[model samples]
Target: MKKVTWKIQYDSTPLIHRHCKKCGKKTRFKSSDQFRINAQRQYLDIWLIYKCTKCNTTWNATIFSRISPQALTSEQLNQFQENDQALAKNYAFDFDLLRKNGAEYELPAFSIVGDDIGTGESAEVKLISEYILPIKVSTLLRKKLHLSQKSFRELVENGRIKDASGQNLLKSKLNGETTIIFLP
Candidate 1:
């Protein structure tokens, strides 16, 4: 087995530069890739994050560190900002549901709690609290967001996915071209 060697090439800043064997160019350590990093640990969550500035060839590196606020330097602060943006994309805001006939339902015949609602379409959607709508309506969220039959079913089978909101993937109504009449 070949012996491993590491050189501490950091200058005045908390940064280091390394010369890559694949591309004989010097690469600087990105600040984001430097936090919570354990150079010796190669876990799946541990990003092997060595990169060449010139060639942009990203590999991995391990460093020892713990999760703490002080560990969150200016560099890590930037990474946090990037992480927050990614977390926000998974959900959408509430949309009011109205029937296709321009009429609305004032009361649900009965309340549905902890039960499967409508199918892929035709489900009623409402804002939180008093803004609730009894209208047989849906957010039309399905068309905008879809799992592409294969992936959707796969997710269901894996059990890693579940619909706790009791939504049906089958029921349907409304098309993409439905005209929108804003409530006054």
Candidate 2:
């Protein structure tokens, strides 16, 4: 049988949090799906709003500043006007917006799901992180694969599982193309 290998890639999952000026502490925020728009003569100002999880304080992340109506497509404008939840979820991961507003963020948690059986005695797996943020590979692997500490250590000792780059996967932050070989 051909060796079963997985070329894994994932999108950036941002840990969205903001400091609550009212509560005087860092708090998780949820997308409000609410927009505040203002018409300044011919230009329009738009914001994507978020509310603090604890206190319900509002934070406005600027989507556009003085943008002409002609600049937006009808669909795009309608999405903003209607407060699309899907669009809001995408916006929730906007690190640029969070950084612009001087808000604090954490690394997002991620997991991988796959079938139990691989094609051969060994399989090549690639882990890709779309986010600019670094992820802890060892912990993620342990959690995702449901492996015990002893089993993981044994694999490491026997060199049955190793990074394709020959670097230590345990200490490194997983990003870009990280290839791992799993021995059955």
Candidate 3:
């Protein structure tokens, strides 16, 4: 099999150093994925729980407010009921949910690994999100590929490589595969 792709996996752990209302300072919250479920008639209320790193104060990121039990799939219910970290990681990166609760969030730290699949002049870098989202990749490429800012800018200006969206790949949000081509 010819290996023609490089895979980059992002870290899903949140970097949302939010301000704890109780602690009165900015603190990082850790997601427990352990939900507090309450049964109300035919509705199920769910909340993804978190804790303040500094003061240990708990905060609830509501997932469902009296949602019908049938609304969630069997797998989703299992994931929530069993405190699945992967599911929680997805929720932790939910910008809408985070903003709805008036919580400040920062981008998570990412670790990028390039998998060499083929020896060729052209290479495809597949960016996979651990949190099921798109993330900016210019900084990542600079750090991983060791390209200076000026050099990166030149590449974008010269149209050497396009991003996932098929445009100049400067600071583009990467969620899928991108092709990097070497020019003669």
In order of appearance, the predictions have TM-scores of 0.20, 0.64, 0.80
How many steric clashes does model 2 contain? 0
User: What is the lDDT for 182 in model 1?
Assistant: 17
RMSD of each: 23.1, 4.8, 3.2
Among these predictions, the greatest lDDT belongs to: 3
Candidate 2 residues 1-184, lDDT tens each?
Answer: 2233333333433545767899898788766877778889999998878788788898888888999999999998898889887676556666667778676666554556444434237777666544433455666566656788787777767887778788886776666457777776
The C-alpha local distance difference test score for the whole of candidate 2 amounts to 0.69
**In model 2, where do residues sit more than 4 Å from their true spots?**
1-16, 108-111, 117-120, 124-139, 146-184
Best-fitting candidate, scored by TM-score: 3
Report, for every candidate in turn, its global Cα lDDT versus the true structure. Answer: 0.32, 0.69, 0.69
List model 3 lDDT by residue over 1-184, tens digit each. Answer: 2224545554545655677899898888988767878899999999988888777788888889989989999988888888887778778878778889777777766666656433224544555544544556676667666779898788667765446456556756655555555432
Candidate number that wins on lDDT, 2 or 3? 3
Residue 174, candidate 3: Cα error in Å is: 1.6
Regions more than 4 Å wrong, model 1: 1-13, 31-45, 63-184
Q: Compute the lDDT for candidate 3.
A: 0.69
Candidate 2 residue 44 Cα shift, in angstroms, is: 2.7
